[model samples]
Target: MDIIRIDDPRDPRVAAYLDIRERDLVGRHGRFVAEGKVVLDVLFSAGRFAVESVLVLENRLAGLESTLRKAAPALPVYVASGEIIDRIAGFHMHRGILAIGNRGAGQPAESLLATLPAGALVVVLVGIANHDNMGSIFRNAAAFGADAVLMDATCCDPLYRKAIRVSVGAALKVPFASFGDAGHITALLDRLGFGQFALSPRGETDIRDAQRTDRLALYLGTEGEGLPEALLSRLRTVRIAMAQGFDSLNVAAASAIALHHFSRGG
Candidate 1:
């Protein structure tokens, strides 16, 4: 791998690495910043996102050689002092790793779902705007082997830097597509022949009692508001059945339990 040494933090080649914390909110015109070595590796495996460039602290370059050669061989790997990188990113990013990933024109929800196999297990997320919750759900989804994630329009960008970091790269590996709204997502799942189950504290059945089918899609909503009453009434509902006094689980925690249960048999 060719290493281009950078002394100035303001170099145009490393433009994408500038004031990342602030620019992250301004939008990247389809580009997303990925941090840490693990995330860079996952970005290579994502297939949908292209590795545009890499910026690594000088000391860590030796350890990342193989990964750079294997995954980002064609991309420029710019090396800089830890201090310079920190200045450029506008924070003390101790991980000493960063990469620019091009989030291409992702497939629409319907198209992405159509690509799944016949017995696919999927997660449907509605109004999960919290990046941390979104990330954790992706991690759980990947851990339990869900085929893909379907998100409603209100969901936050799973590619958001913090979310990707929190997922520890699962967000890159798992297939996901955002769509219209709760109603639209459920409609697509139905047309695709998935057995849909919306999780709610007042669910009609306990999670253990819910039957698993060949194609199952578990729906999880934001914590407080939970699933909308209109949407919940349209689908079958199942609850995790916690202690009597504790009626709810954070969306992420609930997802792990739900995914584990559904993934075990179906």
Candidate 2:
């Protein structure tokens, strides 16, 4: 492994690791920060995203030696004291491991749709701006064996650090693409012969009763506003059966139920 020793927090070589809390908010162009050993394992194993480099606390390096040797031989592994790492990141990073990775050029939505199998199962999102919800949906998508996740332009970045961590690295495991608005997403899926269903509390069909289709797409919207009435009206709709008083579920929980139901060919 190409291990580089870094004592000074301000070293220019570690630019990507500096002030991460603020940088995460401002975005990192096409790059993302991966935290913790589990997340790093996924980032390295996926081989979909390219590793720029990794930062590790000196004490943590010994435990990760084998993983590093096999997973990232050519990559630079920078070691620092815990204090220095904390200073560099402007926060106490308890996990003691962070990796900088670059996202590959995104596949166009049309191209991704074109390559689906005959019995493809996909999750589509519109206006889902919450990072936690975005991550959970990807986790659910992966768990349920969805072919791909297609998100509208308004959705938050799935590659965002918190989202990636919350997903337990499903963001790396699953295939995804981002595209235009609800109309464009629906039109594309329609042209590709996908039966699309928008999930809503007031949906016409109970999720259990929704018929399975060979090629299916489930559209989930943001919390509070949910899917726009116009868009929901244009597609078949599904609702999870709920208790008497509560009319709705949290978006993430709803996604798990919806994805699970669809996976069972309901």
Candidate 3:
């Protein structure tokens, strides 16, 4: 890797990393920010996206020598002082690791879905815009070995810096694609030979009783509104049994329990 020293926060070479907290919200155009050492490891090994470049705090570079060695020789690695990095990122630099990952051209939802093997486990999300929930869901999906994650267009980006950080970088490891809407997704899942289940408090089958098929799609909804009545009415619904007065679990917890059941044949 080419080592470049960035002494000035306003250097054009690092424009992509400027005002990270603000730019993260407006968006980075085709790029996404990934923070922390763990996410940097995933960015290189997962092969889910191309890395643009890397910026490291001066003191932390030695500790990351092995990890940064995975980079292509031509990749630019910019090292800066902690104070300079803090100015560049517009925040404190406690983690001392950052990278710019290109989105690349995203694969279409149907194309991604078509590639799943028989007996694949998939998690489907609808209207889940909360970054924390999105991160936790990806973490659960990876933990349970779900083959992929699918979400409607209403969901948030898994690549958002905080979401990726919160996921402990699982968002980069898991293969995922977003669809236009719930109805289109339903049709696609059916046409693709998946037996789909909508998980909710009023589901008809207990998650334990729901049998896995050659391909399974587990649908989860937003935190507050939950799944729409129409979705619940048209699909096979499932519930996680809980003690009295509790009807549901946080989507992440529910996904863990439900995915564990399918993955381990509980």
Candidate 4:
């Protein structure tokens, strides 16, 4: 294994790793750092990303070396003292393993829409800012057999650290894209003949009995505000039949239930 010892926090070679602390840095480089052995291992096993580098705390090197040798022998791994890593990253990185990789390019809405078969079920998230919830939604989508995830401009990045971790790496494999405007999404879905169903608490029809048409796009919103009134009016409103005591479920949980129902031919 080729191991480089990095002591200086300002070393140019380690600049990419340091950038993990700054949001602007991630934006400029078009990549984010994934920390912890499990998260890094999950990303590496996917074999879809080119790892720029790996940073391991000196004390943890022995334990992680064998794993890296088998999983990414050709990649460069850097050993840094814990204090140095903390100084560089602006936080205590207890995970001990950090990796830098390129972000995948998102496909156009039209192309994504074209790839799905007729009668397929899709998920669309609008203004969902919580990375944890975003990740959970992605995980559920994959588990329940949803074909794709679409995000509006206001949605959080699913590739963010908290999201990626919360998703248990499902975000890396799921097909997703973001739209600049709701109209762009509506137009594309309209062209593709997808019956848009807005999942709202006040929906007039229960999702179980709602007409199962060819190609359905389920629209979910932020937890606090629910679906936007304007977008709700543009689509067929459908609700999950809930027990009388509860008026709603958390967005992520609701997503899981709705996705499962749709997958079961509800």
Global fold similarity of model 1 (TM-score): 0.96
Clashing pairs in 3: 119-214
TM-score of 3: 0.96
Query: Model 4, range 1-266, lDDT digits (tens) per residue?
Result: 57899999998877887646576334635776677776676677766566778888999988886568645667878889989998777789887788777885768767887889777888999999998899899889878777889998899888887787788777766778888888679878977888888899889899888876678888999878988898988889988787899676899998987787777443
Which pairs clash (backbone N, Cα, C closer than 3 Å) in model 4? Answer: 119-215
Candidate that beats the other on TM-score, 2 or 4, i.e. the better one: 2
Expressed as tens digits, the lDDT of each residue in 1-266 for candidate 2 is: 78999989989989998999899899888899988887788777777788999999999998887667656568999999999999999999888999899887999888988888999999989888999999898888888889999988889999998999999888987889988767887887898899999999988999999987889999999879999998998999998888899776889999999889888532
The TM-score values for the models, in the order shown, are 0.96, 0.94, 0.96, 0.83
Lowest summed lDDT window (length 10), candidate 4: 19-28
* lDDT by residue (tens digit), candidate 1, 46-108: 666788889999999988876676575568889999899999999998988998888889879
Overall lDDT per candidate, in order of appearance? 0.88, 0.88, 0.88, 0.81
- Candidate 3 per-residue lDDT over residues 6-73, each given as its tens digit: 99999999999999999878988899998888888877888788898999999998988887887777
Question: What stretches of model 4 exceed 4 Å from their correct place?
Answer: 24-28, 59-73, 117-119, 210-214, 264-266
Model 3 misplacement above 4 A: 264-266
Estimate the overall C-alpha local distance difference test score of candidate 3. Answer: 0.88
